[model samples]
Target chain A: MLKELDPLLHSQLRLGVMSILMSVESAEFTFLKEKTNSTAGNLSVQLDKLSEAGYITIEKSFNGKKPLTTCRINRKGMKAFEDYVNALKDYIKK
Target chain B: MESENKNLSPEQSLDLIASMIRQTQGNVSSGSFYFLLWGWVITLCNFGMYILAKFYSPSNAAFIWTLTIPAWIITMIYASRQDKTRSITTHLDKISMWLWIALGITILPSWIFGSVIDWRVNALVLMPVGMATFVSGIIIRFKPLLFGGITFWIAGTLCFIVSPLDQYLIGGVAMIFGYLLPGYMLRSKK
Candidate 1:
């Protein structure tokens, strides 16, 4: 029996965001947009969804008068990402 | 890049994760600036102190080290600029930063108390530096820095056996091998 793929992480942008977050301590909103090649609006929406699901934390602050957004993967998100990768491996191995 | 909302197959998802990891790996910025800057500065200070003590006067020669005040100020400015420009901070980067900061804090007490007690503090300073370099190398998995750290330890040991003034020469050589050489290597790799 195969594990179910995480619906929240199955999409390209969300998966990309999580992958990037997993590799770093944290990343700025601009960085995610650039790395994922998603429009600002689309990236914001996906980030909000991930934040709502407790997969990531979004911090909004100011960097020298400019509004800054930073995203970090929480422990729950890390576990989910790991489980997702294992499930994906199970599917690919067959 | 694929469309944001599109569903990905398992293989595609794995590939995406692998690629993103590679991208982050390559994003490690150059650390050569700090290494080269401090390497040259300390090397020059050591040699300058040696020459001054040999010829003119040993009384005020240590004052040459005061130049480090300006060097550190410039380093701070350079570091702030780099931080502003950088897009991501990896776990390794954070660890390296804190390790060096801890090293700096250790140096303060060594300097103040060593001078008061009239103790030779070269070994005292160099040991922490070696530990910092070694740990940073382990964090980044960089062989040159790992070797550089060992070089510092060896030089520190030699300082105990050599005459007081010769420690300056040994330290200068150590900076060349331990910091400048590895610094250039890191720059080229970057």
Candidate 2:
């Protein structure tokens, strides 16, 4: 069955972010920024969309009082990605 | 009721993911400084003492090890604390970590099963580490690690060929070439 797909996650930038995060245990915002080649404002907006859809989670804290932002992939997101890939595979298989 | 804590920002979603990953790993950023510093010291000293002892009698080697066990035991009590605070903080770090650990596991047993500690055991350890790295490199395709793993595998085989006699200098050289140097390369890397 095709699971409910997230439109936010469906976008290129957000999709790329999730793809990378899916492979990694977690990553920092700056790392993701460099990776996706997305500007700060745009990446921030895209991440907000994914976060809204329950696909990924964001964290903020201080490392010796300097703020650090970290992101991780969640289980629901993993399942979704696995299903998405499987669904995508169906298209590819034809 | 949809109460005060409303929608999360993109950052918050990222944070949730981070927390979940940490939960799976069960690593807490609660390491003690003294212990980490001591681990650095212990490993370094062990490397040094073991090398120097090869020239002398087995008894002499025993003397060189006088403090290592105590230090290792003591430091391990607080080792987990140090593990968490570092980054390479992503899951990629975890892969690197297990690669390093598997190297230790394979080498440590052979090192312990010592009549003379064949250097070839290092070669055996290299097989998995190399394959993992090479495979991962192709998939994620990082270059240096792939190269490094292959290099270590080749060098490890050489170590075994000339072993025991080669134990002292070659072991030192392989680790320097195989691990320490590569580790530095990875650390200073972008």
What is the lDDT of every predicted structure here?
A: 0.86, 0.55
Native contacts, share recovered per candidate: 0.69, 0.11
Give me the chain B TM-score of candidate 2: 0.50
Q: Per-residue lDDT of B8-80 in model 1, one digit per residue for the tens? A: 8999999999887776785555588899999999899889988998898987888878878888998899888
lDDT accuracy of residue B108 in candidate 2: 68
Positional deviation of residue A21's Cα in model 2 after best superposition, in angstroms: 2.1
Looking at the true structure's interface, with contacts defined as alpha carbon pairs within 8 Å between chains A and B, what fraction does model 2 recover? 0.11
iRMS per model in Å: 1.7, 11.8
Chain A only: list TM-scores of all candidates.
0.98, 0.86
Q: TM-score (chain A) of candidate 2?
A: 0.86
What would the C-alpha RMSD of candidate 1 be, to one decimal place?
2.9
Task: Give, for candidate 1 chain B, the lowest lDDT window spanning 10 residues.
Answer: B111-120
Give per-residue CA lDDT, model 2, range B98-175, as digits (tens): 654565576566546643643235455445555654544443344655675576577656756764444444444544
- Candidate 1, residue B48: how far the Cα is off, in Å: 2.8
By summed lDDT, the worst window of 10 consecutive residues in model 2 chain A runs over A2-11
